[model samples]
Target: MQVQKTTIPHWSEDDRPREKMMLKGRNSLSDAELIAILIGTGSGMKSAVDLGREVLLLTNGDLYEFGKLRLSQLCEIKGIGKSKAVSILAALELGRRRKEIQTEKRPKIDSSEKAFKELRGYFTDLSHEEFFVMYLNRANELIQVKQLSIGGISGTYVDPKIVFKYGIDVGACGIILAHNHPSGNLKPSESDEKITKRILQFGDLIEMPVLDHLIVTDNGYFSFSDQELL
Candidate 1:
């Protein structure tokens, strides 16, 4: 006779994944354990944690890489069906949104590094190119960050008038421009330079300053002000 596999329900409370979570807390669980809670079960022989390990193993145990997986790719793992794959993707999307929400809080952005950190969170959900501008008070603290336009992977159109107009409407003293390079190229292209110049000209016309132009990506960022390109 074959021995039945031990299920999570059968394990003692502390040893059980869900119970372990309730007792200790979320941080107390490992990556695999957290995934196991999403899974709840596995193929006949493998336990939930085992299936979770397989999920991580498929992505080489990189959470960043894991978040980038397509739903169909996630379903490739044994015992992970359409429902489980959707759940995983939903959780990852929620995490990204949380980062964005945290950034929405007012923060002083005095340097390019600080601006990049504050603004990059807005780009986490973008798979294509989009432009944004951060309005700032005279003190260099952020007033608001607003999307200018969206485009295909190659580039985006940023109308200079709308950018500065919004800043004026919001009573901003200055603005910082930002856009994402979906190809992960941190270098600002020729068009990027031309647009920056155009916006700077408009800002000059109005006495509102274009303080910086940032080309940001998942890996890093490029800054016009830092390069003295402005």
Candidate 2:
């Protein structure tokens, strides 16, 4: 006869993490209990909750630090294999993306600093050049943000037509252009100035103004409009 496997169901329903989450709601669960549900199971002599507590201790009880852990680092915990580590990482990434999207949804861009604060998160971690554009309606409320190109550390080529196409597609009346400087330099290159002027001219013709051009770096940002170049 096969021996019956022991699992979380063997515990009282109140003590079972998944059941507690369903009945009492997710916010009712403790951090370890939530992690235990993600891990799903534990090694011999350790319950999932016990294993989760160990993992929390390893990260000094910080969820942000826990999210930064690599797969190899997580696997050092006895019950956390590649699959569990990947699941945790994927969940954390989704949470981060959702937060970014929510921040972009309805904010009006009234100043260079406000635009930088809203858009910097997208470029802060990048190691190469990336061109992004924020489409805005007449009220200066953001409609959407789009990545136009990815290139080497030196620069990226952005097609003005594609930028305008996205603006037209979204019914945008204005736009803000942004690009990152991997070397942490805030000064715009000659190519940057040239493109800004070209795009500004096009926007004027179409009655859709280029509100600003921002050079983002990990340290800070430079705005063309603030410098009186726009």
Candidate 3:
């Protein structure tokens, strides 16, 4: 009688995810294949690639949606234990940090366009509301980016004192405030306008200019400075 080989063992060496990535390059791999490489192996009856396909299905093939998944949420999926879920989350965070570092290298925020380009990536994939501040030096170079608050999908609160305090702490001469509307609306609410004016007034008193307030959504952004609202 002929011996039967397991599915993974039967896969051609060049066709294996890790080997394929090594041979063809990472960009050549599909999303499922890349996830399979991270997952390492699969649960009962599923190949790693097959399990990865299921995960992609769960996120509707959007990597940003996948990135938002919590460890507990990921663990709920078959074949994803705590270890595997942690690996995926760690990988996603590393990618985010890498992008942040690259952006920081070009930290100039001279115009609303530049500010939007720099700040949009941080808010693009978030499911909840997050208010962030980018502190700038005298020359408009970014000193640091800090998250002021996180709230539910509808809105988040930003303390003017805390915002200025971060500016003082970072020795920032100017600052740009930003937050995302998860609903993908670029229109600023009344509260958004009120907060921007308040922060602008406070910045004037502190000698730290509020360069802009950006309302970012997945599709686009609304810039207070660009619209002469700041």
Best by TM-score: 1
Give the worst 10-residue stretch by lDDT in candidate 3.
98-107
Model 3 scores what on Cα lDDT?
Answer: 0.87
Tens digits of lDDT, candidate 1, 83-147: 98888888888888787664445788889999999888888746799999999998988888898
Model 1, TM vs. native: 0.89
- TM-scores of the candidates are 0.89, 0.68, 0.87
Residue-level lDDT of model 3, residues 1-230, one tens digit each, is 96553555569987788988899899988998898889999788788888788878878998877777888887888998999888888989988877676542747889888888888778856889999999999999988889899999999999999999888987999999999999999999999999999999999998999988999987888999889987
- Local lDDT at 144 for model 2: 88
lDDT of 3 at 55: 78
Which regions of candidate 2 deviate over 4 angstroms?
A: 1-16, 19-25, 28-30, 44-78, 100-106, 120-129, 152-155, 181-198, 216-221
Q: State which candidate, 2 or 3, has the greater lDDT.
A: 2
Ranking by lDDT: 1, 2, 3
Candidates in order have lDDT scores of: 0.88, 0.88, 0.87
Candidate 3 pairs with clashing backbones = none
